[model samples]
Target: TPVLLPLSAAVNTYAVPANVLAAPFVPFITVPGTFAAVISTTLPWLAVPILWCCGLAAACLGLIGRAAAGFPQATAPWPEGWVGWGLVVLYVFAALVLAWGLVDRFRYWHMVLLAGAAAAMLALVLPVTALAPSRGLDHWRVALCDVGQGDMLVIRTQESAGVVVDAGEDPLLADQCLEKLGLDTVEALVLTHEHSDHYGGTAGVIEDRAPGTVLHAGSADWDVDAEVESVAELPASVPVYRPQAGEVFEFTRELRVRLTVWVAEAHHAEANDNSLVALFEIADPQLPVGQIGAVSHPLRLLAMGDMEEAATASLLRRDGVPPGVHLLKVAHHGAANGGTELLEATRPAAALIGVGQDNSYGHPSAEIIRTLEAVGASVYRTDLHGTVAFSLGPNGLEAMELR
Candidate 1:
């Protein structure tokens, strides 16, 4: 009895769903009888080999199932607050009690206890996973899209309205992301530079709903027809403007969302030098991530186009580099050319990198990431988190992975 008890308990420990243990033991009872019947008939020698092979296969499969079931949660987020911790402790205690109860009562009650343990664990984890609300979307402010090897940022002007900065390389992806956000119309579509990656999705932006205006740097003239040949053309009267340095484009002044553009006048041999830079500030936004009551604080965000060292240095010289910027958009898809000097000058709290997974250019240079970290700035990359987003409100600031 002692040997049987320990053997049964050991088998149960490795069983997934607390039921797979039956598979190995059930064969022991049925196989011997079936083999005996076969031996009594014509195929006596074959019965032994067939039973051996089938039994081995079943035991292997059961062990595999146990290994799979025992895998720890790698992606699940840890829940916050006392309520969360209490729930976790409760689940562990209940599971232990149910497991102990199973030894005394060996009936359908054992299955009930196993199911109860499962329910307890589910109740503890659901709040940290699927049921949890997105921290950024709870008070949506800025969202950087995962457009793959490109940049696409959206700033919420109102509940159903936003301003798009760059359309990224894929038209369909940019369009779908906007659709998912429930924002069809934008205050304006701001193209930082003429690079296809930054403006290639212009067609998608204008295909379904056209922006109030199209803003770009007056570096080079683009052939409108060729650019939007696949989709639709920018409305002839859409009032395309080439914003100059020190130009403040005001939108939602009452709500306190303001934007100012900065351009460099230095002679540029490379196309990237002419990249347009901008500062987006939200005054005393409503933050929801704080432990205390709703607190009001301003947020300063800087968007760097694919501007190289020369252009960035020129920008710093002209504007004198703003200090204590809350967020920075890492320039040139995190290329090595993305100046560490610029990151140092701005001293932003967080750095956002919009690069693809396994990109050919090896974007988001490791050196740049290390520099940002050295500056005590938290770095969030689209490659790691998918679409990274942030929200700053009266309560506090919150960052989330939209995907």
Candidate 2:
């Protein structure tokens, strides 16, 4: 169990006890459920009673699992990848050898040695693993956090401040991403739309942080008022704005960044079509001093929220797509409805798709990938690359994938 710890998403403190409690219930359901399935074709009456008993047992097992999961710190974070795996292997090997030595020699000092070795291993590994996510983040200007089937994009404003777009679904995941980025203040929180996947984690992003303002989509067609109130997470002091299309928000006081609202109105009946599309123009911060005739162009990032094909087409007609986009945040998690017209029009150098691994929606459709490839755009997905980040390099845009 210790050896396999690194491979798990989290370590459940009560897992051992929970398994022990659920062990008896497993057979009570499985055995009868199997028998019930086999006999249902021939003897329906007998199968019914057995199936009912199995259902009751399954319910009890579920209750046990839920209760265990509800406990505080039930799922403790663990180090991921090869580093963690290697350390676990080393620790297990040392412990096993020490245990064998104690059994063979039976010395009082050997027990003390084993205990000391275990403590040392944990002390050495835990701190290093905990700090892993924050490493190499200094150069990152934009980060697409891996929040699973949702969107959370952080654009750096200052050393410890950023403008967050879409908070994702899980509060813990959202909070962890911001914490890992070392962002103490959110200059602006952009809830692209009222969708749960995009705004459900608002509480996490604002918790223990200085939030300046919130920019959201509040169309007349949708009951956005109720949805906004439902959050109940935002502080009363924080102001909320529902900006219209073409409205520009500048951050020139500190960072040379301008956010232009592209689409804020509802074009289609679907809620996703009303997603708040914004274009972020961030000036290159890495330009060399007094370079003659060297033009430093601001990196343009088009965050398309979840706007589908119809809305995108409408946006193109109403206000044409911005050319020379450095980064494109793929819409609708790269669903088929995301449309290829905008991809072709923008022809961004890099495209990012925020979607979960093995998602039910079959996001980031093969068609979308093919379109991006056709337009010579490098595609990065959260499901495949984990957390993807971009920064202005000496030559051009540099991408870093934290898996």
Taking all chains together, each candidate's TM-score versus the true structure is: 0.66, 0.64
- For TM-score, the strongest prediction is 1
Q: Compared with the true structure, what per-residue lDDT tens digits does model 2 show for residues 1-403?
A: 5645634444667988999999988998988899999999999999999999999999998899878865665655556677666666666766686878867985776677677767766886779656754323565778999999999999887888889999899889888888867789999999888788998888789888847988888345655545656764667788888899889988755556788998787555787877898898876444564321113567788999998897788778977878668899999999998899999999988999999999999998999999999999999999998887786544567676654
Candidate 2 pairs with clashing backbones: none
Model 2 spans with C-alpha error above 4 angstroms: 1-135, 221-225, 289-296
lDDT of each residue in 288-391, candidate 1, tens digit only = 43322122445777888888887678667876886557889989988989788899888787888889899999998988998999998888888898776786
The predictions' CA RMSDs to the true structure, in order, are 12.2, 8.7
Best by lDDT: 2
Q: How does model 1 fare in lDDT?
A: 0.71
Candidate 1 steric clashes: 9
